[model samples]
Target: MNDFLLYEKTGGVVILTMNRPEQRNALSSVEICEEFEDRCRSIERDPSVNALIITGAGPVFCAGGDIKKMRDRSGFAPAKTVIDTRDSYRNSIHRIPKALYNLEVPTIAAVNGAAIGAGLDLACMCDMRISATHAVFAESFIKLGIVPGDGGAWFLPRIVGYSMACEMALTGVQIDAEEARRIGLVSRVVDGAALMEQALELARRIDAMPGRTLRLTKRLLRDSGQLSLDHHLEMAGAFQTISHETEDHREALAAVFEKRAPSFSNR
Candidate 1:
């Protein structure tokens, strides 16, 4: 829907490409933030969307915030005071994580290159991450004398444990794809040329599931982190009750007994 972000659909899978190659797909402006929020809402409303893959347009995944804009205190909603700055972040850049978090579809971050500062946090926002061999990542906001005002602190620690998150946040050191994989930041790392192919393949595999149940499963997994065992089991039981009543669930069982591939209506 916007120039900075490209939306493409192949069957039930959607791909969102950060299309600002000239700017290294930096999360620099309010427009990019709006684009991400809008597209995510659209995807959520569309029942046909079962999976999402997010990646950058060019060699760089995302350079984080625009340093020039930051230096001048001019991007997103430019503010002249502390209160105004807080409001600006809440109104602008913060929308991406909130939107992505609320999105029902399973999400994947296909990291093609550098993911620095807020960029690294953006990848952490997704359910799964796959990286290209040439990709590098860092919690580099400390290097700029700015903390992650976009909720990176919350996400980074959740994705990579507290101690590793502390090291990355405090030192602002960059790590390669293999290091990311070893640290459980990315599940897989492949050649740069095959990144999208690998991501799409993974997305398509997930897309083959029954749609309603897939969304419910994702919601359960996400909410489980904040829930006690008893509360999570109660919620899971309620969701499973709904799943069992769907036509797709019946078809799945029938297919297993018949020894045939199941075709989900995604009900």
Candidate 2:
């Protein structure tokens, strides 16, 4: 892990902390994006890690892009042409969402404070979101005279519906944690001091499940949005067949009959 990103694991849950409190954990530098992608890949290969929780180091969850870098064009790159700028986004910032979207394990965004612009989209990339009472969210790209260049356009609508997503994106207004929860953007809200505890508690519940089952279930959910009902049912059938053959499945069945907890080895 780099200085800007901190990685720690306890049992089946891995916590990823954006460590740049000074910058409000802004996803501005190429290094931050690269490190994020690398960590996603690492987690994908680790079966022992059944869940992930993303949070920031300080009060601010993330402030999105670095304004100074955008003005100076130093954080991205020196791009003289439109094509250069386009490629910079494709090869740099875009990688974070692509990598995250493909990650096999379940992920939770523990929004500690401000999640603005691309930062809010970053939280949306996760499978679930839980916010602190002090946290705020916004699809704030319009405020900067830009659009959702970092997949916010694609993600926000799915979480908060088309009308609400449009309202936020078009107006670039900030919403409190309670509003976020009410709109279904975040699943729950907790006291600022209990944010991580709440997130970790949820992570542990998810992590206790069979690892392969969790991955397959997540994949099914991801594809369900795009798949027809017939196709989705077929895919689910195939996955269910494969899952039934796993030792973890047998253990789960045995535990049910024995009235005991299942000990899953992630098999």
Candidate 3:
């Protein structure tokens, strides 16, 4: 609800914009993390929302943690004690990944500019990523003499593989949009002006699908990474059974036979 995070819904696509342009939309305070968790809860409760797009408001997508706050020994950095630092990460920034990973809706990250440290991990949390040509990314925690405390270790390797993730995390070097695409960090890169346009177009395509099926598919994919082949197939079968019983499934089949566009209720 705060101005730091802006939420807008169009049809089944929801846009969540980080609005702190002045600080380059840094995750500088507890408020930003809390607002993000609250918004995820709202999105989960809203049955009408089938897809989400996350982006930043200004030139930089996110500068990651607030360097200024770190310098002052305030905010999420430089806790008074080691235990306090651990608690800070657990209670604050960790909530974003927990909420987003469990979110049923399809999510996209439109990286408009710089995505450093935790910002890079944030994009990795989404189902897909599209970047502006001017956008840059870095696993920059090493440069600050800290490890990735915000799930970058978990998210980065899955997207860019172990070697690349290790290189990025160890070196803390920046990669441009084209390099990001080459390494499979981003699916595509476009002009800065076209960033949102491309992201919304992708969101609209996903929004046109049945909401229940979309959620189920995302769940299956998430589980697939952890489950054995046999177990995954069994899970897929169970979900398929449920999918077949949905009214939207029947409508889709009927439309196919009738040679017409399917009218999905998103049931």
Query: lDDT tens digits, residues 116-211, model 2?
Result: 998999999999999999899999989888889989899899999999999999999999999999999999999999999999999999999999
RMSD of each: 0.9, 0.9, 1.0
Give candidate 2's whole-model lDDT.
0.93
- TM-scores of the models, in the given order? 0.98, 0.98, 0.98
Task: List candidate 1 stretches off by more than 4 Å.
Answer: 77-79
Error of 3 at 112 (Å): 0.4
Each model's lDDT: 0.93, 0.93, 0.92
Q: What is the lDDT of residue 88 in candidate 2?
A: 89
* Candidate 1, 60-140: lDDT as tens digits: 999899988987879854758888988889889999999999999999999999999989999999999999999999999
lDDT tens per residue, model 3, 1-267: 567888899999999999999989999877788898999999998888999999999899988998888888898856589889888888889999998999999999999999999999999999999999999999999999999999999989989999999999999999999999999999999999989999999999998889999999999998788899999999999999999999999999999999998988977
TM-score of 2: 0.98
lDDT (C-alpha) at residue 261 in model 3: 89
Model 3: residue 84 alpha-carbon error in angstroms: 1.6
**How many residue pairs clash (N, CA or C atoms closer than 3 angstroms) in each of the candidate models, in the order given?**
0, 0, 0
